[model samples]
Structures are given as C-alpha cells and as structure tokens.
Target: MSELKIVDTGNELRLLGMDEASKLLGIQKSTLYDMTMRRAIPVVKIGRLNRFKLSDLEAFINQNRQEAQS
Candidate 1:
C-alpha cells in the first residue's frame, strides 16, 4: 500500500489508504494488513485497492476501547 492522500469532499465519506490508517491506529502497516486479512477490522474494497472510512475506523476504536479497572 502506498501513502496515498485521499481527497475529502463536503458531505462525503472520507476514505484513507493503508498507510494513513496504520498511522492513525498507531500500528505498523503489516499489523493493519494482518488485521484486515483476519477480518478483525472493517475494510472497503475499491477495485483492487483497500480503503478505510474515517467513521468506520472511529467506530472500531470505540468498540475496542477498554476501561481501566481502578
């Protein structure tokens, strides 16, 4: 995956490339790819390319968030 910059239009869903998604999640590209392959993360297929939605990524983070046991 390349560090491709996706254009954002008003009222349109924001899509990100693998590199951007990995960076946003603070993980390596390989890890992200593994998660995608395992179906652990939501991904969008754009005709031979992988894309991630900003809203979906945010939802994934929220779903996986764990509260600290104090």
Candidate 2:
C-alpha cells in the first residue's frame, strides 16, 4: 500500500485516520461513510482500514465547489 500524508497547519505532513479526516473536513463520520458507500469520495483502503490524505479531500471539496458554482 502507498503512504498517506497530511499537510499540517505548519506546512508539515503526516498520516491521518477516518475520524481525523472527517473532523478536518467538517463532516460527520456517517456522512463520510455514506460518501464512501456511493464511491463519491476518494479513499485508501489498507487491509480493512480506510484512510484519506488531506490533499485528496481538499481536492474533492474544491472540485465539488467548482461544480456547484457552474
């Protein structure tokens, strides 16, 4: 599996879990789970664990925002 990196506030990077990703994205766990179920969100599954990179989530949000504006 590839590495998951998170860009910190200080411009540093680290790995993050589902809970952290949800909190950072300002969404509920169930909502994140729903997105995953619909394959609407990008995720990394390692073994039985699911993870997400901050950059990926940000990109997803940006893409959605642009779509909404259009």
Candidate 3:
C-alpha cells in the first residue's frame, strides 16, 4: 500500500496580495479593491503594501453567508 503525504506550504495562514485574495475568493480583483477601500472587508496594510489573511477571508465569507440568510 502506498501512503500519501501532505506538505504544508505555510502560506495558508500568511498574508495574501489583492490579486491572490481575489483569486482565492473567486471574485474580481476590482471588487476586492473596492471592498478594501470601503473597509467592508478585513485587511492589513504593511507600509505601502495591502495584505489579507486567509483566516480573515474565511470569516468574511461566513459572515456574508449569515447575513444573506438573515
């Protein structure tokens, strides 16, 4: 029997760029930027760079889902 091993990239918890976050969320890049500018989504800024955490994105999605159902 062969066993499959999973490798952790460590990026799952790290910050993601706008494009990366958009891709992950399956949304348009422009929409993500607009949300960020409006403070409608969670994000972190490091100097001149904007970053989003995977955890924060997940939470945002969950919150949206709940809001839609309510």
How does residue 34 of candidate 1 score in lDDT?
Answer: 94
Task: Give Cα-based local distance difference scores for all models.
Answer: 0.83, 0.75, 0.80
Would you list the clashing residue pairs of candidate 1? none
Candidate 1 lands at a TM-score of 0.81
**What is the C-alpha lDDT profile of model 2 across 3-70, one tens digit per residue?**
33444685334446889888987899999988987999988887888788667787777666532253
Please give, for residues 1-70, the per-residue lDDT of candidate 1 as tens digits: 2333434564468788999999999999999999999999999999988899987777788778776787
Return the lDDT, model 1, position 15: 86
Per-residue lDDT over 1-70 for candidate 3, one digit per residue giving the tens place of the 0 to 100 score: 2222323379666888988899978899999999999999988999988899877887787666532343
Q: Which residue window of length 10 is worst by lDDT in model 2?
A: 1-10
User: What's model 1's lDDT at 28?
Assistant: 97
Which has the greatest lDDT? Answer: 1
Report the alpha-carbon TM-score of model 2 versus the true structure: 0.70
Q: Arrange candidates, best TM-score first.
A: 1, 3, 2
Model 3 residue 52 lDDT? 93
Give TM-scores for every candidate, taking all chains together and pairing residue i with residue i.
0.81, 0.70, 0.73
Task: Using TM-score, give the best candidate's number.
Answer: 1
Error of 1 at 20 (Å): 0.6
Number of backbone-clashing residue pairs for each candidate, in the order shown? 0, 0, 0
- The local lDDT score (0 to 100) that residue 51 gets in candidate 1 is 93
